[model samples]
Target: MNRRRTSRSASAEELLSTLQHLTARAREEVGLHQARVELAQALQRKMLPADLPAFPGVRTAARYAPARDGLDIGGDWYDGFLLPDGALGLAIGDVQGHDVEAAAFMGQIRIAMRAVASTVADPGEVLSRTNDLILSMDSSLFATCSFFRFDPVTRELSGARAGHVAGVWATSDGRSGITSDAGGLPLGIQSGQSYPVTRRTLDVDGAFVLLTDGVIEGPSLSIGDGLEEVRRLVSAHAGASAEELADRVLRAAGLTGHEDDAAVLVLRNEIPSREAASPDGG
Candidate 1:
């Protein structure tokens, strides 16, 4: 009886020690994961544009959200910048994965596209050049991107979509819905792919919503349904500020419990009050 009791006590002590060790290891892993997330977020911030270029005739706002259930996040990004020719450029894209490499590839694509866009001027040419750049990188990954250049002076919108979901376009006091167009293949899939360009006039006080697939994708809802939801949201809030509209769109997407990282760019054609004075000159 005495020997059995001693044996049982020894086994309990060993088990307790093992449990304590596991608990400590688990805590360390959690801390390490959190640190990784912070680092990844910092890298993402650096990769994305810190400020949207201040163009007088266009109001632009962007938003980015990491995956809710990810450790390092994914390669979803948005950017808006003023081109040398005074065109307001806006872009959003998603690389083909959820890893550091995806994010790195995203950065490469963005830089290449920006350079190509400012110089090329044509939206289709920009994506075509960017596609060539991606093909040259020898990466197995691919990306879906959309590019838009607004000629505020002419109230013209030129866009090129590369196998990405359709985006929403609206006039403040007029009709609003997803614009239809022919988009080419996604980037990195082929060496000499060409994206078709779509042109439209914003008329006045118009807005465009450019986003990644994650924005209109969820488990329970079909992509079509999600798009309709976005359409409703945009139409309902046509007169809101760009910043507010961006937040609201993101909030609406959040309610869908999107598992992928999401990025949104909202561009409005309203001229700033200050720019109103300068008009065409500004």
Candidate 2:
């Protein structure tokens, strides 16, 4: 009987020890993940523009949301900057995966994309250059991105997509459409694949909605349902300011429990009535 008791005690001790070791390891992993998330968030915040450019004839608003709950920052981002010819560069991209490494890679790709965008005159060329840069990087990672150069004065929005999510364009007449093409593979997947450049002339007071796949890839809903919800929200809030529209879209996405990193960029036409608004003679 004494031997049996001893054996049981030894077995319990061994099990306890193993449990403690596993607990410790898990704690360490959690800490490491937290650190990685912090680092990634900092890098992403730094890469994205703190303030939208003060350009004439256009109003812009951007919003980014991490997952509902977690320390994992995803690779979803947006960028807005002024081009040489008084045009506004509006872009949104999602690196193929979500995590610290993806976010870091996104930062690098973003800078390279901006540089390529600056040198290229057309928005399509900008995306082509950006895609090349992504393909040249380490072959393991992939990403999806979209690029656009919007001329507020002319109401022309020209852009391209590299396997990114479809874009939303809500026209002044209350009709809405999606801009998605089939050819371009996700950036970083293959070399020499090209994204077709598409252009749309904005009607009076038009708006564009750009987002990450995360917006549609939530746990509680399908992509089509999420999109329809977004469409409803945007339609309800159509006349609101750019910032308000962004807030509304993000709020709707969040309320729906989107479990992935998400971002939205709302570009609206706020053209001036008089020609004097554009000093550069556009």
- Give the top-scoring candidate (TM-score): 1
lDDT of 2 by residue, 1-282 (tens): 999999999999999999999999999999988887888788778878888875565789999987645556888889998887778888888876667788888888888888887788686678777778867776577878888888767778888888887877665567766666543777787677767788878756667888887776577877777777777677666667889988888777765567788899998776557675688977
Enumerate residue pairs that collide in model 1.
none
Measured with C-alpha atoms, the lDDT of residue 268 in candidate 1 is 70
Give the Å shift of residue 240 in candidate 1: 1.6
lDDT of 2 at 16: 100
Measured over all alpha carbons after superposition, the RMSD of each candidate to the real structure, in angstroms, is 3.6, 4.0
User: Which window of ten consecutive residues has the lowest lDDT sum in model 2?
Assistant: 174-183
In model 1, the worst 10-residue window by lDDT is: 270-279
| Displacement of the residue 47 alpha carbon in candidate 1, Å | 1.3
Error of 1 at 101 (Å): 2.0
* Per-residue lDDT of candidate 1, residues 251-276 (tens digit): 77765667889889998777445555
